[model samples]
Target: MIKRVHVLEDDEDIRYIIGVLLKDEGYELQLSSSFSDLKSKLKDSVPDLFILDVMIPDGNGTDICADLKNDIFTKQIPIIVMSADDKNKDKSLGAGADDYISKPFDIDHIVNRINKLLVK
Candidate 1:
């Protein structure tokens, strides 16, 4: 099965870039610009992995990550939290994110991390 990745990022350019790259890497991609959109998407189907921005227009990624981890339905999904602010690293990890990527993230690194997580 093609692995599905859902990304919650408010930056249009970054969302587009990640979507394109993940698609090219042979994974299915769903992109959401806000927490509301992400929630709506979740109602339809869960993704194999999630990439969330630390600070989004409607919510905080770490909080979302924690919620997902705590939920029975989503707890097994690997989450990768991203932020321009490196200070959010500890918070993201504490929230049960499988990985944290700092922005201006290297695309290869994100891809590699996703691969590693999905392989588990």
Candidate 2:
């Protein structure tokens, strides 16, 4: 089955690149830059995975990750939190993210992590 990935990132350039990379790997993507409208984006479809950026306009990604992990309906979906701030690596895990990726991320590393998570 084709996996769907929802990416909550404010950086347009980075978001597009990541979307293209995952799309090339045959996964469908839902890209959302607006933090205020995240719920709407998520409600549009159920994704197999989530790529969350810690810093976004008007919202915190770790909190969003935690909320999703806590929800019965979304608890099973794997979430990978990506941030340039390495300081939150542990916090992201504490918040229930399956994995953490530091920004300035390598394309291969991103692909490998996604592949690894999707298998579980």
Candidate 3:
């Protein structure tokens, strides 16, 4: 089965790049530019994994990560929190994210992490 991945990134170019790369890897990719958009998508179905950007226009990714972790339904989903500022790594991990990635990230690294997390 194809693994599903939901990504929330405010930057259009970054989102597009990630989408293309993940799609190329044969994972089903869902892209959202805002927290509200991601929430709406979540209502349809939960993805196997989530890739969230730390700072967004409407909400913070760490807060969303914490919320997901707190919810019984979504708590099991692996989450990868990323940021342009490397200092936010601690904040991301503290929020219950499974992994943290620094922005301008290596696509191979992100893809490998996703593969590892979804290997169950």
Candidate 4:
């Protein structure tokens, strides 16, 4: 089955880049630029993995990550958080993110991390 990935990022360029890269890897990509959009997308179906940006226009990804982890239905989904703040990696991880990727991240590394998480 093709794995589905949900990307929650407010930056258009970054969001587009991620979508293209993951699509190239044969994974279905779902993109959301705001909290409301993310919620609506989730209502439709949960993705195999989530790539969340720490700072979004509507809300913080860390808080969203926490909410997802605490929810019984969504808790099993793996999350990979991206942030420009390197220090937030620990915070995101503490919030139950499966992995943290800093901004200006290597695309190859991101793909590898996603692959590793999906394998688990």
Candidate 5:
């Protein structure tokens, strides 16, 4: 099955980069800039995975992660919380994120993590 991944990242360049990377890797992509956009998009379709930024424009990514994890519909979807701040790693995990990747991250690392989680 072709897996779909929803990404909430405020930086246009980073979002574009990830979209291109995932699309090339044969995963379906849904990109959103804010929590509201993510919520609206999810009403139509739920993704197999979520890549969220810790600092988003409309909401804290950790908070969003917690919300998703608490919901029965989205709880099983793997969530990777990323941030430029390495300090938020614990917070991300505390919020029920499956993984945490700090910014300046290697593209391969993210892709590898996605592959690993999707396997389970």
Candidate 6:
């Protein structure tokens, strides 16, 4: 099955880069640059995985992750927290993110992590 990935990131450059990197990997991507946009996108469909940036303009991804994890419908979906704040790893994990990736991330490593999470 082609895994669907929803990326909630406010950084335009990083978001574009991630989208490009995953485009050829056969995963369906739903990219949102804002909290409202992400919510709107989720209203229509839920992706198999969620890749979130910890710091966003309107809200933090950790909170979003927590909300999703608490939701019966979205609880099973794996979440990957990508952030520039390395200190937030523990917090993100505590918030129910399945994986954490620090900023200035290596594309190959991110891909490997995503693959591993998808397999689980």
lDDT digits (tens) for residues 1-120 of candidate 1 = 899999999999999999999999999988999999998999999999999999998899999999999999999999999999999999999999999999998989988999999993
For model 1, the superposed segments whose C-alpha errors exceed 4 Å read none
What is candidate 1's local distance difference test score? 0.95
Estimate the TM-score of every prediction: 0.97, 0.96, 0.97, 0.98, 0.98, 0.96
Computed on alpha carbons, the lDDT of every model, listed in order, comes to 0.95, 0.92, 0.93, 0.95, 0.95, 0.92
Candidate 1 matches the true fold with a TM-score of 0.97
Report the C-alpha displacement of residue 53, candidate 6, in angstroms.
Answer: 0.3
Superposed model 2: Cα runs more than 4 Å off: none
lDDT (Cα, tens digit) per residue for candidate 5, span 1-120: 999999999999999999999998999999999999999999999999999998998999999999999999999999999999988999999999999999988999999999999983
What is every candidate's alpha-carbon RMSD to the true fold?
1.0, 1.2, 0.9, 1.0, 0.9, 1.1
What TM-score would you give candidate 3 relative to the actual structure?
0.97
Distance from true location, Cα of 8 in model 3, Å: 0.3
Q: How far is candidate 4 from the true structure (C-alpha RMSD, Å)?
A: 1.0
Alpha-carbon shift of residue 60 in model 5 (angstroms): 0.3
Error of 2 at 70 (Å): 0.9
Candidate 3's C-alpha runs over 4 A off are none
Q: lDDT, candidate 6, residue 56?
A: 93
Cα deviation in Å at residue 107, candidate 6?
0.5
Q: Is candidate 3 or candidate 4 better by TM-score?
A: 4
Q: List the residue pairs that clash in candidate 1.
A: none
The deviation in Å at residue 54 for candidate 3 is 0.5
Cα lDDT tens digits, model 6, 1-120, are 788999999989999999998887778899999889988998899999999999999999999999999999899999999889899999999999999999999999998898898983
Ranking by TM-score: 5, 4, 1, 3, 6, 2
Residues 1-120, model 3: lDDT tens digits? 998999999999999999999999999989999999999998999999999999999999999999999999899999999999998899889999999999789889988988999993
3 against 4, candidate with superior lDDT? 4
Per-residue lDDT of candidate 2, residues 9-119 (tens digit)? 999999999999999999999999966667887777789999999999978999999999999989999999999999989999999999999999999999999999998
